[model samples]
Target: MIHDIAMIPMIQTQADETQKRKWLQKALNYEIIGTYLQTELGHGTFIRGLETTAIYDPSTQEFIINSPTFSSMKWWPGCMGRSANCCILMAQLYSQGKKYGLHAFIVQLRRFDNHELLPGVTTGDIGPKLGVNSNDNGFCRFDNMRIPRENLLSKYSKIDPDGTYHPPISDKMVYAGMVLSRVNTVVWAAGHLSSGCTIAIRYSCVRRQTELLPGGEEPQIIDYQSQQLKLFPQLAAAYAFIFAAQNIHRRYDQIQSEVMVGDISSLQELHGLSAGMKAFSSLATNLGLEVLRLSCGGHGYSQASGFPRIYGGATALVTVEGEYSVLMLQTARYLVKCVAQAASGNILPHSIAYLTTEPESNCSAKSENDILDLEILVNAYRHRAHRLVNEAAEQLKACLLSGKPQHVSWNENHMVLIKAADAHCHYYTVMNFVQYLQSTEMSKPLRDVLTRLCQLYALYGIDNNAGDLLQDGYMSGEQISMVTNQVAALLVAIRPNAVALVDAFDIPDEMLGSILGRYDGNVYENLYKWAKESPLNQTEVHHSYDTYLKPLLHQSHMEAKL
Candidate 1:
């Protein structure tokens, strides 16, 4: 419902206040169910490729909408399978045989009272998915459907009763809704990552493993350095992601403010930031959740452990909103542009200002102490990211210099380009985490714990991509080794606070729903109770035995006597 309402401002026009009011009021009051229908069978994230057509008929003041092919049918919209009676659709518009770009339109899909499919509207459920099955994801196709000319969402573009078309002042306004979704997904991923970390950490604190000393009782699994190594960093990352998301969301708000005044200078930057973080954050959380689940050993594989459902739901996000690789490339293209601007001495946006920085000869760290400094780490990351972006830009230039076409050059350098974008996003996220820690006021003990976690998050990022650091001359082999040791040491320091850290997430047990991760540490008892409550265990299960096994045994005995 919120997503549907959000579409209003994106396509709201001065010409159709009454139309906007009618739909907006219905949506807000739940008088009508609505959804955004952008993705189709042929197009998911790339909106430019949408194939649906809306041809205006000036004589009748109506637009004929049609899904010319099966691939043009709208797919993967929530509530469209059965619930949504209307949708905000993206379709190419044509007036007087001059095709304008894709525009939004309001189209009815179902009847309001009986929930029947409208004439010329075909829809059905898309069936079960990896997760979020309760959403009722649906498919839709239009067959020469005629809607009033007023149905064309004219906020950015409009048509008169005489069929004169007026394009929006800024075409970028068409995508504000999608940018909002991308930013929201980053914050959404943070919540899921925190939940998974909380469950795994709490369970590890209660689960015991082999004893470290002779004749001593087994210690909690959380005591193992390997366990801490897997869980603690993710705990820190969950916090880092929340901080990053907050920053991005705030920037989005600012972007919205600027857009209201017809200032779109920041739109491109916001798009790149949101897309990169959306991809990076979802992938990190998905991978982290799986690692946390496996850190619980065999219990993690069971549905009762709560990891499978969490993992399933999270994995679905990687392909939604945008595909991971595609978005990375989008950010890469933006980075390449930044490199070009920086080379010409043109001022760059603050997000990519690092591209203008020259790597300092003494940037490489000498000792573990120096490596642990937040300022040093941020500088190193900036240097490596700067080098990577420039390197990718150089590769593209090299390809083009060799006489390859622009598209061919892009294809050849795409792999390197994505890596560059990923590096930039990581650096930016760590910067956000570090800056948040430096600026916020808190108790000494809380601040100390957070600073350690922030360090862990930043260093872990550096260590994971140490090849980038080393290859870009930001760190030497010795320094990389020192980073490895520092990571181990941080794990030890963070071990004692693992439970406390996860508890700080404050996820309630009711929401967690894991037998192995309950707050009371009664895993075995809960498992037993769960088994007992199973339908199979409700009775002695003699019915199956009497129906098939007993008869089989009787026949076997008769045959043996013969």
Candidate 2:
């Protein structure tokens, strides 16, 4: 999967017959492991600002690599600590006294025979993290590291033996890998959310609560409207995300195919869409996992439940690939550009064409069936998102026209603009879900369940943005209540299928690695056995504890008598 989703377009250039026979084949055969190391302690998001330098020395016919400061040290590259023997390192390239932006260098960090660090290389493990601990993320410093002229991954940019430089066909091509990585992260988020929802939903079904009637047995927590409200919407979101994942993946694959054929027209759109979707999807999945965790009550807090680890792992994604807020701004910048282009009477791409249209104030819905229609709710969200984006753009334009600088205007209205971008992305996801369900390829039974989930997701989203829905007359106050009620009812209808639904995801026990979430329904027994394995339980007491407690008790008794 990682190889198939290589982010750096340069990697593709290097993957030709000769290079593949030499490097790629070895890596595929497990004779070598390589880390794509781009992030540094000082620079992560802003690749343009990286400090590591790679100078082309024509006399020696080598590239001299140096990490100029502690902050310039390579950080956060998976498998860099111990597993990787080579790495694709990003460094600022210098040749003939001129500086080129960040470029990739294939550097040998360890010997193939002994696996010892090479001279001029300082490296160590970054230690344990919140999750992804199995990946040996590492830190390294390069001091005057030298490699042959061919070491520079020159498919994109290169220096000849004479120290003359050649530019990449396109500057953005260098960053294509990172953008693809971001898109892959979006699909990964869907899988993580599905895993969490599956566990929570299955547990909810088996765990029963208070009896609903005098002679009735205690009902499954899934039967309660409140419980349904909490878990079912998340289940719905899980399905929605799965569908969105497929859409984004298809879009990414199409973009890759087009780029390979030298079509650069859609690069900017794909970059922005990938960034926005990754940010949106990861945040939603993170939040959804938390909801699933809380729905499980105190058990969710236990490590045995697996929610803690899953939640931690999922939440870190918001920061790792890119910080959520920062990535949202990337999307916002693209959105502003699209809005400007649309204002100039140009046709926008399909991904953002909604931004060009005027929003309607009223949407018609009368009966429960009408309100429950997923298309109707999705359309309502689309209109609301359009309205928000238009308003945000106007606010930004007004500030700019009043003589405020672009950065200043952006800073002043950053929150509103980001929120608008987020709304737009959410609407896209919901529409993707609706369209996916409408496809003939989908099974009828699966479609019915997914349709309910779509409605639940839309209603939950709308309730959160009730003010916009009301102000735009997308829904009346009473209609809002009716939708909310129907959403609640749908959750109840979905309860019986919760266990079966999650079961279909098929996460293995080894991968899940939780006692409470075990498949056999022996949570308490496993919990007890796990507790007994703790080191503290090996011995009943230490001599110090016994002596101190007995003395303290005797002293207390004598003092009381006195």
lDDT of 1 at 528: 86
lDDT of 1 by residue, 513-536 (tens): 788778788898898888888887
Q: For candidate 2, which ten residues in a row score worst on lDDT? A: 1-10
lDDT of 2 by residue, 273-309 (tens): 8888889989989988888888888888888788877
Q: Each candidate: RMSD to true structure?
A: 2.6, 2.9
Against the hidden reference, what TM-scores do the models get? 0.94, 0.92
Predicted structure with the largest lDDT when compared to the true one: 1
